[model samples]
Structure formats: C-alpha cells, structure tokens
Target: LDPNRLPRTIDGLINALTGELDDETLLIIDDAHLIDEQPELRALIERFIMAQPPRLHLILAGWHEPDSPLIATARLRGEALLIETADLLFTSDEAAQLWQQAGKTLPVDFDELMSFSAGWPLALRIALDATNWRSALGLREQKSKPALDDYLEREVFARLPTPLQRCLQRSAGLRWITPDLCAAIDPTFNSSELIAELRRRRLFVEPFGEHGVRFQPLIAAWLSRRAAADPEWVHLHRKAAVYFQQHGDHESALYHQIAAGDPAAVTTFLPLARTLLAERRAEAVLDWMRRLALTGDETPELIEIQAAALHQLNRLEAALATYRRAERAFAASGDRLGQSRCLRGQAAIYLDTVQPAPATDLLRRALKLLPRQCGAERIELLLMQAENWAN
Candidate 1:
C-alpha cells in the first residue's frame, strides 16, 4: 500500500480494506502493537478481527499481545486462539521427527531434553546441536538476571558499527525511545534515521507506539556491560541526569548524577537511601553505593549514604560519626534540609546509646529545620522525639 494512499481515518481505512479484501487474502502487519496505540485504530482492528473474513488469513505480529479489547472478548468466546511461547516449545515427538529427517533415531531421555528447554525454541536448538543432550540438559538453569549477554554480544552486538553500539550503549537504561529522549542522550540524535537503522538491521528494538520504541531487556543488559568501562559512561550519565531533571524526574536524575559523581548526588540520594534502608533493601543500596563509590572521592552526599547504610546494619557509633561529618558539611553549605537529616540520624544514635538529653536536643533542632509538610520525615521526627524523651 502506498503511504499517501493510506486512509486518514479508521473508518476510511476499514471501508477501503473491506472493498479490497476477499478469500485468499493474507494481511500481515509486523510490529502491530505499535499501530495499536491509537484507540480508534485498535477499535477498527477489533472489528476487523471479529468479522473474521472468510478464507482470509490475517497476521498481526508483535512482541506483546494485541491491545484490542475485542481480542480478549474473542478469546473468551472461543473465536480466537492464542499460540504463545508455551505452544512454540519443541516436544520430544517433534524433536524426534526432526532428528529422523536428519536420519537419527530417537535417543533415550529425549523428554528430559525437552524438559530442560522449558519450551524455549533457542534453548532447544542449542541442546539439539550438542553431541550429548543429557550433559547439555544438566547445564541448563534459570538465572535471576538475563544470561544472554555473551550470546548476544558474540552474535549481534559485536557485529554492529562502533558508533551504533555506542548509541545503543548510552540509551540502554531508557525504558522507551522518543525523539526528545534520544536527543537528550545525545543532541545529534536523528530519530527517523536511527529507527530506520534499527529496523534494517533487525535489532531487538521494537515499536512501542507511533513515535516510541523500546530495547529488549537482554540487549540493554549486554550494552550496559559493554559500555561500563567506556570513559564516556559517566559523561553520558550526566547528560541523562540533565534530561531527567528537565523532565521532572528527580529520582532518576539523582541516580544518573550519582553515577556521574556530582556533588549533589548524595543530598538527592539521602531520602532514597533512608527509604531503601527502611524497606530492608540495605544490601542492594550498599551494592549500588559501593559501585558508585569507586571514584574514591567521598563527598558529603556519599558520606551520608554510607552512614545511612551503616545505620541499617546497626553500626550505631560509626553511623553517628559519619552523620556528624555530613552534618557539618551541610551546615557549612547552608543546606538546612541536609543538616536536618544528619541531625536526625545522629539523634537516633544518641537514643540508642541511652543519652536522652542530647538526643532530645538534636531532634528539636532538626524538627525546626525540616519542612513540616514532609509526611514521612515529620512522622519519623515525631517518633524519634517521643523515643528521645522516653529514654
């Protein structure tokens, strides 16, 4: 179909297609989910699907399920059948048949081979190629994280041009692609050209909507590892921080800025650190902090983050010491909020040490400095205030 000839409205498009479509017509739309972003278009598609034109084969391929509610209705009514990842799994019978085509008889434990594959077609292919399926089956496992980095690196990423690889690397952390975000990552970004390249190269990038796309997680992980050591990694993160900040995403901005080792990273990271600590995610926060701490220049923000981590481990005295240092830095910088946080931290240590007088004084001072509107912080201060007097 010609681009200019394409209908401007869903009704117009459906009417045109209705006149043209008949038995033996096969319609295919790759990345169909992207086209499903428009409510009107999705509605049209649902009607088209419900009609189920006689002898017409229609395919709407995408990584995700169709966005049409009618598709769900069709499924519930037994008018539509879904062939998903599970159905694509190679059964022992299918595998044996394929092996027979290659003149090999069924081997023992073939079902065991299928079991290890868990219906993943690629895993099955790899196992079938192995001389010993049992050994291959024994080595199979589920990973908490994606384990396809090496395979993708060798088979896909390594083959790309350096500039494209770098582009993908810098953009990996993003959940979706838009012209604005791409431009934010690198001002030289040309959305149409990059999208065209991705499609031509058959990369894992998929259309998210009319003007959006997303990287497959495994591909993103692989690119992240590949670009981890690049000198531009921090600079790229800094750019990302600016973008996120401009877009009103302070939390994400803080993460990228922290990675960039900006002095403000700690101040921004503190509340999140406290939240993670409270959530019992102290270990994960520590791992994140340790990795970010590698630059070896500890700012007040880093100090506070470390202190917060220490507090989670109940290393009271050490946390108190670090908090004091962070407090002085905040006071000197005229950052009342930061100073208030440190004071609260120190007060907690004092109460734990059975020193109520000093703890009470610290809490009172912090209460004056901390914003009254902060619900969590205010609640924390109130609890600590009560505990200080009780002790």
Candidate 2:
C-alpha cells in the first residue's frame, strides 16, 4: 500500500485489488467535478473507468455534467449511465403523494402549484409551508414568499457571476432563452458565454432545444417580479418581440408584443392566429382567443380565424354562426375575398353535414365573389361543387 508504488496500468491495478476483496463494491465521488481540476488524477480515473474492472462500479455526482472523454466513451459503450436534473423533478402523481404524506388534501389548484414550482422539490417544499397557498402558487401574482426569496438569493442567485446575474435579471420575462435572445436583451455581455455558464452552474435553468435554455417556473416568476418595476423591462420586451418576430416564432412574438404595451399587439396576433389555424393548430388558436379576450372583437379577419378554428374542431354550428358573422362584416367592409372565404367555410360545414343543396348554393356564391387570380380558391370551390352534384 505504499503511495510511491501506485499502479499506473489497468492490469497492475487489477493485480493490486485481486487479493483485497472478493465482493462487488461501489465507489462514489461526490463533487467529482473538483477532481477534474487535477489533470493527473482525472486521467487516472479515466483509465480506471476504461479498465472496467470486475464487480466494481463508480458513480460521479456533481453540479455539472462531467467534462470527461471517458464518460462520453463509456456512455457510448453502454457501460455508464448519466442521470439529468429533468429526470429528478417530481411528476404530478409524485407531487400528489407528497401532499398526501403531509396529511393535507390535495389543493383543487394543485396543477398551479406544479406549474409554479416546475416540479422543483425545494420550491414545492416552500409552497407547502405557505399559509396563503393560492397566492404563493399564482403565476399572475408573481409573489415569491419571503422564505423562498431568501433561500434562492442565498443559494442560487448569489452563486452566479455578476454578469450572469444581470443577464438573468434582464431576460426574466423571456420564456425560451437563447444566446441570440440574450444578446438582444443585453448587447454589452457575451451572451453565449453567460448562457454556457448558466448551464454549467445548474442554476434552475434547463437546456431546452438545440440552441436554447429555459428557467424553471419559480425562478422565472421571482425574476419577473424583480424586473417588473424596471422601466427597461418594457423596452426589453419590445426588443424580445422584434427578435421572436424576426425568428418566425409568431406566438412568442405576440406575447412579447402584448407585454410591451404595443398598440400593434392585436395586429401581430391576427396573423399569428391565422397561421395557427392554417397549420391545423385549432386548439392553439382557440387558446390564444381566450387568452387575448379576442371573442368580443368585430374585426372580420379575427372572426374568420376563430370560425376556421371551430370548423377544424368540428364545432359545426358554432363555426357556421361565426362564419355568417364574418361574412356580414366582410361585406360591410367591401372585402370580397374575406366574404368569399367565409362562404367557403360555411359550405364546408354544410358539406360535412350532408346538406349538399345548401353547400352547392354557398359554393356558387363564393366562386362569384372570389377573384379571378385566385386559382387555388376557384379550384377548391369547383371541387366542392362537383362533390355536391355527385351527392
């Protein structure tokens, strides 16, 4: 066991261990990332892992994924398993069990608790302690119980570098955080480095897609509250709106546009609603309608998009009524194309319900109103007319 006689090769290590024990063994290294700071020790561990010694298991735990070639290579060879933060978050059923174990009936708004906590165990514990639990779980309220704030400040935010902290504060309202979005939020910072640092720190941010990350709901809610009174918040939202719009994420763009208190938010929404309808995301279009309170609008295009969504959802009578409303509005506005589209929508419901005669009449009127250059519209109407005749 002389320190100077340590085995440097896999075979020599096995020989050293052969007479030591006869049973399976586990070797776990917590804060294993610290070992990574020592190149010689890190290389020794890597070699040991490559050896795959008999009945020996090694587990490495740390705040960040290991920056080790052996870890990746072992993973590829199915000799190693890596568990991520997302894997450890509580499921809905697990959260329910937690409530039951606490000797409390599950709250009716348990889903809100789950959403607010984002299944983070620490956040859930904090929420479970609140007397005014509804306010604690309310995202709209954006209230962080003092205990929650204190813990997060001391444990999480305080651990971040100053620049990263500023970046998070500035981009608090953004749902999906990308390097490009971060750059748009604060041009003075090297956003890519800040984002990479965030991921490495494991500071309540999770890798989202190929190029983005998202804050856990509790973190986002807390930061949003802090950013609320900043006059620059609205300006940042405007910049976010422009960024998302340029990136073709119309739904997120619309959200930011509204948050910016932009007068053109509705204009941005109309096109996004139409696009959602066209993409057959009918439920999404309806969700946006309710979210934006667009139901009371008299705009022809808004009515048309809602009607189209209802049509896709097979709410035929509702769709027909809405289409009729849109058709009248279009006619009053002298928009022949809008009127023609509404007629086509009504005819589709009629055709669906086996009312070919009414559908044929609607299609004929639509064809007359539709412009001559509308080849696809004309073809669709002619095809519907032929279907009606066949019926």
Candidate 3:
C-alpha cells in the first residue's frame, strides 16, 4: 500500500481498509513518523483499528516511535504493534547476501560496507549500485571530497527537473519555506507537487505539516554552492526578500535583500527596526540597524534610522555621533524635518546618558526651530521636555 496517497478522511480510510483486506490481513503502516503530526489522520487510523474485525492486525514501522494520540489509545487497549528501523538491519548472512548481490567476492572486509552505510536500506542500495563495491569502498576510505560531490551530484542533482532544481536553489537560501512563498517562487507549484517531485528525485526535502518544508543540511549547503554562480542569484535573493517582507518576516527579508546588495533595503529595514524596538526585541533592532548603517548607501533618512536604533540600544556615544552625522547631512540637504529629528535623537541620547540638563536644553532649542502652529511637533517636544525634567 502507498503511504504517500493514504486516505485522509475516516470514512475513506475505512472503505479503503475494507476493500483492500482479505481474511486475517496484516496491515502495515511504514514510516509512521510521517503521520505523527496529523492528529486527525491518527484519530481516523485509530478508529479504523478499533472498528476492525478480530482477524485484522496492524503493524507500524518507523525510525522513531510514533507519538500520535492513536498510539496512546491503542496502547490503552493493548492494540498497537511497534517495530523500529534498527531491528531491520542486516545480520551476518544478510550482509553476505548483499555483498554477493553487489557482485563482489566476499573478502574479510565485506562487512565494512554495511558499517559504512550504517545498514540503512537506501544507503546500502545506493552503495551497491555504485559500479563496484570494492572500488567504492576504496574511494570512501580515502575521503575524497571531489569523489563524494561527484557521486552525490550524479546520484542526486542530475535526476531533478529544471524547475525542481530552481526550487532547491531558493530553498537553500532559507532555513524554512512557507507554502505561500513556495507557491510564489514557482507559480505552478503546490505542496503535494513539491513533495512528490523531491521524493521521486530522492532529494532530501522534509515536509513539516501543511505550512512548512525543509531540506537536509548537507543538501541545502550543496544547493547553495550550486546557486552561487547562477546568473539569477541576485534576482532569487530579491524575490525571497520580497516574499519574506510580504509575510512580515523582516529579519529574513533583510538578510536576502542584503545579499542582493540593494540599497533600498535600508528603507525596508527602518520600519522593521522601529517595530522590533517597539516589541522590545532590542537585540534584533540593534542587528538590523548595524547592518543598515554599514551596508546601506548614505542618506539623511538612513543615518536617522541608524541613530534611532543606536539610541534604543543605549549606545549613547554611537547614537550621538550618528545624530551629528545625520544633522550635517540634513543641513546640507535643507530638510528641516530631518534636521529636527536628528536634534530630537541627539537630545534622547543625552537623556539616556543621565545628562537631562543638556537634554532639556536641546529639546528647548529644537522646539524653537519648529513653527509655533506645528501642534504635533510642539506636543512631542513638550512630552520629551517633561520626561527630561522627570529624569
């Protein structure tokens, strides 16, 4: 039975089970780890097991023990059968059979192949298919990086379709991808299609419920290298940045946009920095501000953002310096609003450093700089002056 296309609903599961069964049938659910997170499916499976005739037996095989509610329910009624993958490893005779199947004469070191493959069925199968076991053993012993890359490249990447290859490239840039972002990247893509394509190609894409997907660390690293030289590297980064930004993941968005080297990322990150500061995520605000300060192009707005972040982080000396720089830039640009903000940020720095006297003086000067009818500006300055006096 194909576990991949298993019936999702309780009635569907029951009908499928009844139609597939004969007298005293043994129903095995392999890779039980895959269904552990699906509580509904697990409940349906449990219901089927409970409703089954006495002649039916259920066997579950998985790397990890199943943690489903069904497992607990079945255990309460003493109905669950569990077998671990470790129990399926080859014995001495089975190892000999595998070696023989690979068309190799049994040497004293024959069992080393099993040890090298860690007796994993898939790994053992792949090793056996590698031209000759003896030669492959020799290469494996030498620890040749090129040989390993070539083996994995041919065995893995060479089998993927072009679109999947692109998907993998994007996935490499991310720790995880949401379904919405994946759909954005590949217009025709869906979760099931992505899973099927990756599984069919034997690529290491791991599905996490309905919203997330991941790739093996090694595969992701390799795909990252493969994508480094692609002409669309910048485009992919920008696309990922946009997707992440749309999802309100500003940190991830900033990372991709920084990789793309887009100066406009500074503008994108400023509001994010403010939000982070508001959330009291000071460390993250500091990080984004530092990146924006270092990587972003020079502008009065960018400098003001850097100054604001520095102020929030209690880097009073740095904030003061940044405010001075922004003040000069604003003066040169004749931007009175920018100049007023720089002055206010400088005053805040002074207040942060226990210099409330100077801070009050700075706020009074800033208040005079604005027009009398600027009610919002006057109210803000009044509040800041009151805070300074309270300090």
lDDT of 2: 0.79
Score candidate 2 by TM-score against the native.
0.70
Angstrom error at residue 165, model 3:
6.0
Q: Tell me which of candidates 2 and 3 scores higher on lDDT.
A: 2
| TM-score (C-alpha, index-matched) for candidate 3 | 0.54
Give the worst 10-residue stretch by lDDT in candidate 2: 1-10
Off by over 4 Å in 3: 1-167, 196-210, 215-222, 242-253, 289-297
Which candidate achieves the best TM-score against the true structure? 2
Q: Which stretches of candidate 1 lie over 4 Å from their true place?
A: 1-150, 157-176, 186-217, 228-237, 254-288, 294-302, 312-346, 349-391
Give the better candidate number (1 or 3) by TM-score. 3
lDDT of 3 by residue, 217-294 (tens): 445545555555576777878888888888888888888788678887877877776777677776776677665555
**Which consecutive 10 residues in model 1 have the weakest lDDT in total?**
137-146
RMSD of each candidate relative to the true structure: 12.9, 7.2, 14.2
As for candidate 2, its clashing pairs are none
